[model samples]
Every structure is written in C-alpha cells, then in structure tokens.
Target: MNPFDNILDDEEIQELRKNHNHLRIKFNVLSIFTIIFIFSGMVLFKREKFPTYLEDLLNQPPNRLLHNINQSNRSNYSNVENFQNSLVSNLNGGKGTIQLHSQNDYWRESPLFDALKSGIISIETDCWYLDGQDYELFIGHYKYQLTNYKTLNSLYLGNLNKILDDVNSYNYKNSIEGEEKKGVFNDDPTQTLYLTIDIKNNPELTFKTLQQNLEIFQLKNYLTYYNTTSNEWFKGPITIIISGENIPYDSIKNLTIRNTFIDSPLYEILDISNQSNHSEFELKYSNQLSIFASSSLEKLIDYRSSSLSNYDFVKYGLNDEQIQKLKQYISKAHELGLKVRIWDTSINYDSLYNSLKTNIGINNKGNNNNNIIWNQLKELEVDLLNVDNNVDLLNNDAMIAAIGVSNNNNNNNIKYHDIEDNYNDINSNNSLS
Candidate 1:
C-alpha cells in the first residue's frame, strides 16, 4: 500500500533512518556497559561464599515464608496437601527420625499417624475415665470433644502396638550386630517414645484404668520399668509418664516395681515449706521416680515488655533473679538426674485456634510472641519444647539453626530422653521408700 511513501518525501525518509540507527547504537552501548558492570561485581566478590546468601534466603520465618509460598502458588498448596497424605502413608510404611510435640492437636486429617510419620517422639494424650458402661476410658481435651471411637485404646495404644510390631519385624529381617531391637523409629534403635498420659478426670481412677490398659503392651516389654531392690531401670520402647492433679506419691508408694514415672513439680519441690507430705518421698524417689520436672514457662521468663532484647537483670536470659530460681529448680533436677520441661509456653496462632475451636483452651499463660520465648528457652538449654505445631517446630529454619542441626528431626538419639543414674548421697539418708 506504500502508506509511508505517500506521507514522507525521500529526504525526510533518509533523516528518519539515521535517527533510528543512532538510537539502536546507544541502546547496545548501554547493554554492554550493564553486562560489564555485573561481571566486575562477580569478580570482585568471588572470594566471598555464595552459599551463605543461600542459607540466609532459606532461613526465613516459617509462617511468613509458608504464607508467601502459598500466595504465589495457589495450586501448589493444593498439591502439597496431596503430597502430605502420600508422605504420611510412606512414613507409616518406613522409618523416620523427627522430634515432635504431638500435644493433643490435629495436624492433618490423621493426627497421631501424621505425627509419627513426621518423627514426633513425644505424644501427649489427655485421659478421662468414664464411670459407667463398662468403665471406658476416653481420650480428648474436653468432655465435648470425647467420642467413643477416640478412646486411648483405639487412638493411641492400638496404633502404637502396631508400630512396635512393624519395627520389630523390620529389625528381625535386617538385624545388625551390636544393634539391639529398635523402637518404632528406624534411625535410632534406642529411641524411647514418650507417651504422656495427662489425666483430666478422677486421677486415681484414670491412672488405674491407664495401668490396666498398659498391661496389653506390658507383656511385650514395651514400657519402661524401675526395680526398687536392684535400683535398675529397664527402658522399653515406650515410656509412659503421668501428669496432672492428684499425683500423690502415697498412691503408688507401696509397689516394689513401677512401670510409670511421675512428672515432678519443679517449682513447688524447691520450697521446703510445701514439702509437708512429700518431704520423705521427694528426698527418696524424686530423683528415681521422675523423668521431667516441669513448670509454667510464663512463670520462668518475664514477657511483659514489648522489647525482648536488653539482657537486663529482670527481663530475659539468666538474670540474677532467674538464675537463682533456675539453679534452685533446674540445677536440683539435673543433680537428681532429671531433665527440665517447661509447659504452657506460647504456641502459634494456628495451633492456638485449633485448640480453642475444639473446646480445648490453651494454657495461654505466656506471651503472645512465641519466637522470642522459644529463642530464650533454647538459650537456656531447656529440654522438651512443649509446643503444639509439629510441622512448624521441625521445619522452622531459625529453630534448626539455633539448635545447631540442619534438620532437627534427623537426630533421633533419645537415650538422652531419660536420665540414667544412681541416687547420689544427697538423698541417701531418705531412702525409706
């Protein structure tokens, strides 16, 4: 159609072509300069480690990072759910080494199974002993949440027995010299699975029901036991620890051999005035009969201030006041061969919501900010993080870095879970039990 020819004369067209060529040359020069600048920067920083930047990129907050990832890949999150189901299936079949605080919360469609698949070693189950209808014991955080199908036998013990059987079968087929029969966990054969039975109903009745149910696994030697005469402990595949109200030492004092251990009151035990009834028991069996000495984390750490920094005497870390208290509490427990576990530490919103929605109110005694609290606990070297988020705690980059593990779940060494020791002379005179 020659529309440009009709609009412009030959002299004007020549001028247009020259102008276009000049612009093209200028653009090419700018592009070449930009490339040179980038190359120079690489050469200048060649001595520096590039992997450090990559690590920094990966170590973002789990919630924020997961949010951004989900926002960007809406379809990918859907795929992740599908992948999670497959992951659970695979874990049920195979072995994994992840530490978990499966503390009576639902993570996936399957709570306990998902927790085990992810290598959660610690599981907390709240038990309520029913009075009628053949004396059934139920498992739930509240009366409303309890269901006939969700009994401790149905949800926890039955599944646990299956896991033990599977692990034993795997070990028999693939036995290694010097390697004893491992627990459900494949990575660490000596890892002891902690089944914390927190009683919510009549403590004596609930515990009695629990002990009766435990007899199912007792024949298989799947529970830890203490011999009073020999002062020897046979750590089994599963260690049953009891917590909650009415944990009177007088209840189980007469037994020559005990399978279950008690959760000691770290705070109350320090005060001699509160030792009216427990004085003899505390002196005699506090060291041997208890594995974890727990108190409220809020009581330990001051979280009133907005700023979590400032290593002042009143705020964070081992301030003078805290140092005295912790030494009185933690040091005594450690001296008595017990590890410290602080409960009621703040958990994330997702977990909190899940708890509240299910009529299971969180302790909610600590600060809303959990990251700072977690950091402080790690710095204090407190054992057994009483958290609700199984996935976040295990996957959090800051948590992994702070704990000095690339993956916190990979280390399944749980011989450190229970303290192995003989009662020292500190309580030698009070061995009346």
Candidate 2:
C-alpha cells in the first residue's frame, strides 16, 4: 500500500474539500475587489487632473528621472553605444560650416553629443554651483530646474575628453603630416571648440570646480592656453571662454599660464576709445587676458526701435559713423591681436527674431533681414558672427554666393567667421535674459 494512504476517512475528506473550496472562493472575491479598486483609483486620479501629491506618487521630474536612468545599470551600455555611433557618424561627415549654437530650449536632447554630431563646435551653458550635502556643479537655465545628472562633466567635459581621445587615435593611425590629433571638426583640425561657460553663481567656487574637474584634459595638454612669459599662444583643440557674473578678472589674471579666458566688454571698449585724456589713460584691457571682445548688438546699434529693420541696418550696419567706431574697436583689438564678436544679433529660424521681423519686412521667399545683417557684418569683416540657426545661417545659398562676390568697394575674397550667438540669452525684455 502507499505510505500512510488511510490517514483520513470519507467524511473527514469531504470536510477538508469543503474548507479548500471556501478559501478559493474568498481569494477570487478578494482579487476581483482589488482589481476594481485599482481601476477606480486610476479613473479618479485622471479626472482630478493630477494633484501635487498624485504627481509625486505617479511621476518623477524629468531631471530626477534622468538622474535615475543615468545611475541605473540597464541602459548604460545602450547610451555608450549610441554616443560612440554618434561620434563615428560625426567624424565621417563634413564638419558643418556654421557655428551652431544649441540654445537652452534644445538642452533636453543629448546636449554635447547632439550639437557635436550636428558639427556645432561652439556651445554655451548657464552654469550654477550647487554646494550641499552632495557637492556638485549643475547646468540649467533656471535655478529651480537644476539636476545632478546634467552636470558639466556628464554633459560636456567627459564627452569632450572621449571625443578628443577618439580623434587623437584616428589621427595617429592616419599619420598625416602635422596632424597628430584633431578637434571635433576633423575637416578643420586646428579649429578650437569654443565652450562659453556663463557662470550664474559663485564665480570663484564654480570656476575652481571647473578647473579641478578639467585637470584631466589639462594634463593631456588638450586645452588652449597663453604663455604670458613667452608672449605666445598655444591654441589647443578646446578653448573655455568664461562669461557672465562680472567674471573675476583678478582670478584670471593671477594664473601664469591659463586656458580659461574672459569675454571683454566690447561696448565699454568703445567708450574707453573716446576718452578725452590720452596722457592720463592706462590700458585697462589686454588681449593676452581675453581672446574675444564681445558686446550687446542692440546696444552697439543704439536700440531705437524694438525691431531689426533696414533703417536699423543702414543706421547701424557698417555706416560711416558705425563703421568708424567699429573700425576703431576692431583696430585696437586687432592691434592687441584679439577678435571682435557682437552678440544679441539676429539668429535665423529663431521665432523671437522672426516675430521682430513684422516691421523689418520679410523677403518673398520668407527670408528675414538676417541676411542683410550677415552680409553687412561680412563687409565690415567682423571676425565672428554671433548668430543662431547656424545650419541655415552657414549654408544659406544667398550668403554663400555673396561670400566671393564684390562688396560696394569691389573687395574680392570676402570672408565669414563661425556664428556663435546663443539666442537663449535674448529676453522678451530686450536684455540678456
């Protein structure tokens, strides 16, 4: 017989069967009730329009979510693979002709990789220093939106380092004459990636943190620097130009050999030029300290109206008076061997600029006065055109055709510099927002 088969009698067996059936019925009823409760809760939640508490429970803020995603092991490999593929694709393509400024609105995309892949060498970030229990540097347009995931190292420095290494490896293998390594733009290997770091907080702390973090690149000799003693510039693949927050001049000046440069006040330089006393005047600015002399484009034009028009163009665009002032500034800066770049200008394809075009008159093909401003700047031979919609601004057929054409004076071989204006800094209030 089977071991212990006769443990229960027929009546006992019947009682046991009844108990099991009753328990199963209770479980089924409980499960159905649970399902109904969940369904009802979801409907109620949706109808209520997502309350604060509900939002906290149901959804996480994008930055926080991104932080978690970055920390997680699941997508690490995929992200790396994607980045590698993007780098390879970028390397294979012709470097974009324009200096594409990926504005604050486009930060949601992979900031560094996306812009680089698009062949945009220059990028700006509104940097904030976050010092708390967990000390970190964060980048965000506003203070409230700061997140740990989208940091300087994560978004820029690390990716830059990787790109540099990859490019160096490629150059080494290719072994071209005087091409040991290249920058993000392989076609123009000597072109420096202009990284404008606009400090929105404690300049000393933030910049110190930046310098400490960038030590790896510095060690690799991958940063542009000026040897003050030798009076020579060693232009590397990447140049970090610090702007905003008055930018501690002494801090920058104290450094013997430094890659970090400041954006000199171009408008102020104009005032300093018209000084009544030349004998008592002392040079307050030096090109050794700053590579670029930049200023507000609106201020430069004497912002009479809220629109960029032909009137504005003629009055301000390379006129005798404006050109004289511009020439003075350019001459002084060029004497110092510094390039001039005017900011707060028109960025084609930007809606803000387009909206201002109502009074300015758009072309039959929907082109705005951007071309006029661009051509005028080219005629003036502005070293850098700070503009938006870089892809279009660079490849605009009209602008390209106008490049080799003669100006009013019939000067052949007109030149164009990379456009580096970030439109996010432009505000509705007509200031640096």
lDDT of each: 0.56, 0.57
Prediction 1 TM-score vs. true: 0.60
Which whole-number lDDT from 0 to 100 does residue 139 have in model 2?
A: 81
lDDT of 2 at 246: 47
Candidate number achieving the greatest TM-score relative to the actual structure: 2
Q: What tens-digit string does per-residue lDDT give for candidate 1 at 1-433?
A: 7766679888899999999999999999999999999998875464132211211223444343223333334434443343333222335333345433567743233546545655667778787878782346787788898767667776678666755644443223333422333465544455677787778878777767777888756666677666677765666778877877656455555456677778777666566424667666464336567777777755554444454334432123244555455556666666666777776665234543333323222233321232434445555556676656555544545443332333333443432133333334323522211
Model 1 stretches astray by more than 4 angstroms? 1-100, 105-109, 133-135, 170-181, 273-285, 301-320, 347-372, 396-399, 402-433
Candidate 2 local lDDT, 341-432, one digit each (tens): 76655522363344333444444344445445556665565666554444343333333332222212233223355333322322121111
Off by over 4 Å in 2: 1-92, 99-108, 133-135, 170-180, 273-284, 305-320, 347-370, 391-433
Best-performing candidate as measured by lDDT = 2
- Each model's TM-score? 0.60, 0.62
- The per-prediction CA RMSD against the true structure, in angstroms, equals 20.4, 12.4
Candidate 2: what lDDT?
0.57
Reference-based lDDT, residue 66, model 2? 26
